[model samples]
Target: MQRMAAIDPIAYGANRNHYDGAVTRLSPYLRHGVLSLKEVSEHVIALVPTPRSADKLLQELAWRDYYRRVLGERGDAVREDLEPYKTGYQPSDYADALPADFLAAQTGNDFVDATVRELHETGYLHNQGRMKIAAYVVHWRRVKWQAGAAWMYAHLLDGDLASNHLSWQWVASTFAAKPYLFNLDNLLRWTGGRFTGCDADGRSPFDASYDELNRRLFA
Candidate 1:
């Protein structure tokens, strides 16, 4: 209730994708039934003049409900790929498990390692961090989406089975039109330059243009 009461939907719409933004941080509450989505939506509806003013916040709540529906309909099938790899690599080409180096935050990518360390130390991560890390794991590391999904679900405080797994699927291109990839520019733009994408020894695998990355990772 307190979280919902404090929501600034306009700010959320403008800045929710940034590392530091006016996010409601209400997922854990909603996930555990501390609050209901209906009530939360209503609160936002009453706050703004028109529904459009809170459109982004309301849409995200709707997405949570949508994922819940998918979970109900799909059952455990959500744990497996719903579509074949669209990244020009066969299922056999991807590793079955996350690399030990990745779990240990020793992947030689500063942004990836820093996000790993943050997740280990804190139970929560911003949605952008989740997407970026997911893209890195499933795309760059070539680890199976299930592996990445399980790792995140095990640690996240607001871990909804549907959202966590399906989002990994999206990044893996098993549930989306194409694989999601991020470049050094995108990372720094969202992160506000907190991470330089440079590894400890001054190399950065993420330091490339999107076209260059597309050829390197997917082509």
Candidate 2:
């Protein structure tokens, strides 16, 4: 609780996308109801004493409430796509099972492999890492969003069905206008060069530009 109380919202907003960012690490507590979103938001605002400094952190908390509202309105439909996939493929066209390479952390993308292993070992993943892995699974591997959502729920200590499942659907383009894709350059920039030096390998799946990726994956 001290950690949560000490969060610097300014620092959090600036570095939240980085792998080693200044995140509050309060999701597990919030998910399990150890702390309420309103309480946390109020507390942070009190400490920060500036609307701009606390706005980003509060917006993040608001996403939790948004997901909860989605769950309330949709109920069990949250387990399925809320809208048609923009990729032109139906949910039935994707595999129900995640690939063995993905489960075993051998997807040939070092960043992905390490992130998966981190989830398996730590029950937590950075938010950016989670988005990247979700995009890779749903778009690149052609796995159903529900399959990846289920796998993530099973492992995440902070797992909330509304957030986890809906976010997967967002990445799959079932609830968004376009599918989310990440490239090697973005990965390196966010992760601080930990997974660099992949130019020689022709097998790197995320090395292409966004236009090329869209053509290859969604064409």
Best by TM-score: 1
lDDT, residue 15, model 1: 91
> TM-score for model 2?
0.95
CA shift of 157, model 2, Å: 0.5
Writing each residue's lDDT as its tens digit, candidate 1 over 1-219 gives 567778999999999888888999999899888889998998899999999999999999998998889899999999999999899998888999999998999987788888899888997898989998999888888989999999999899998898899888988999889999888888888888889888788977888988888899994
RMSD of each: 1.1, 1.7
- Worst lDDT run of 10 residues, candidate 1, spans 1-10
lDDT, each prediction: 0.89, 0.87
Worst 10 residues of 2 by lDDT: 196-205
